[model samples]
Target: MQQVYPQEPRPFVKWAGGKRQLLHELERNYPKKFDTYFEPFLGGGAVMFNLLAKHPDMKCHVSDLNSDLILTYVAIRDKVTEVIESLENHSKKYQKNTNFYYYHVRESEPTSQIEKVSKLIFLNKTCFNGLYRVNSKGKFNVPLGRYTNPNIVNKENLLTASRILQSSNLEFFCRDFETVLHDIKKGDFVYFDPPYQPVSNTANFTSYTSRNFTDDDLERLVNLAEKLDSIGCKVLLSNSKSKKVENSFSSSKWKIKEIQVNRAINSDSKKRTGHSEILVKNY
Candidate 1:
């Protein structure tokens, strides 16, 4: 496997709660070794890309409930050239009228896979704060960002990611996180980065999809983690530093640590940096 791209492959979209900032701490806590890797909450795949960069041939099973995100992965993995071309068209049209073109694409419902993926990337890049939020009706409702020049067509990163996806034995899914329980086996590593529990009343931004990841969902996730632990699967999880999260994994079987992280979504510069998140693992 020759490394063609000079840079490392990365996530194509700007996903909320993406782990790009926490990669170092995450690498430190990663299990010494495992047979395969599974990430049920595959937002912006920073951890997966980091692992794949080091071990290109590692078997990976990643999934997300956001169908559009999964479609972008599939499109890029299989049809990167087409996706690039479509994105270029978007880039051109966007320059002519940023606000109008952005909103038009946002309101559109493209039927083709390539079009849908390209539209998603365009919206992610041009949307406010690079945030992926939707209304209860499943419509992308984020307004246009203020970026004078957003990198809507990131060709180099996309190419690198596509090459990696083509070379690796990876599986992508658009399903509930709990579904992985049926396929996981002993010694497999599963890293869960579900939507963080809101620390404050004003911090609720879990609307990655139309279905918000609720408190009930978090409880189900805790149960799923325990089940994975009992099945002998190496499990790791990341979430906001909240009492609910801390108390849920308080059992003796888990190794809980608090790591500092920066919050990018907050509008206030004062509140944007120096936040704490919990990393729980069962080795």
Candidate 2:
């Protein structure tokens, strides 16, 4: 299911701290040769799609703790046509009333896996600025977007993504990041894009889903990287360039490189700018 000339690349959803800009840098740092590719965080799948575009023959394994995100990938891989159709229907049903949209989104239920996947894609497409924010009760809480003609669904791109996914010997799972180590072997490449340590106490945005990756989780990730490095696997990780983060991984083996990344989540336009982030690698 390889396309001779795949269509222009696009991300399926808007993810906070998505790595669209870091793709090229990641490609450069990634080893030229590796047995398999694994990404544990898998937010918006920017890296996975970039890898598929560049290396069609490479085996890939991707997982995410968020079931909704994994379901979106599964939908793209298995039910592209149906999911696109459902997204279009959802876009048409969107009303100007914010409360109406919020309750409609909050009240909807899916009977099957496909329907559940469709609901996620629908909410993601119509939510405010495509933000995936949730309440303490685990309900989708993002408001309605003000776009007159949002590309709620891109059938061609989704179809192209489906073909790209089909070409590679890839596996998708919804699990904790720690589970990824079980499948990684020697000479494999593992890219970690965990929720970064916030730059300041007030800047914490680790709550991508209901669960938050805390400081302890970040330490655990460092340990995993050290273990992978010990076994001869190449590991690269990205996190906010904070003193706390630097102190956490300030050891002999991990090399840190600072890179600028856009910060678009803040309300203040000035604050919604680019800043430095650390790219920790075991070279």
**Against the hidden reference, what TM-scores do the models get?**
0.97, 0.92
**What TM-score does candidate 1 get on C-alpha atoms?**
0.97
Q: Give one digit per residue, the lDDT tens place, for model 1 in 1-283.
A: 5454356777888887889988888999999989889999998999988988887788899999999999898899999999999999999999999888998898889999999999999999998889999899899998888899999998999988998887557999899999998799999999999999999999898999999999899999999999999989999999999999999999999999999888777767689888899999988
Q: Per-residue alpha-carbon lDDT of model 2 for 27-119, expressed as tens digits?
A: 788888889899999988888888888777779989988888887788788888887777666666664554576457657877777668767
Q: Give the winner by lDDT.
A: 1
Question: Any runs in candidate 1 off by more than 4 Å, and if so which?
Answer: 1-6
Residue 41 displacement in candidate 2 (angstroms): 0.3
**RMSD, every candidate, angstroms:** 1.4, 2.1
Q: Which residue pairs come into collision in candidate 1?
A: none
Clashing pairs in model 2, backbone N/Cα/C closer than 3 A? none
Off by over 4 Å in 2: 1-5, 95-99
lDDT of each: 0.90, 0.79
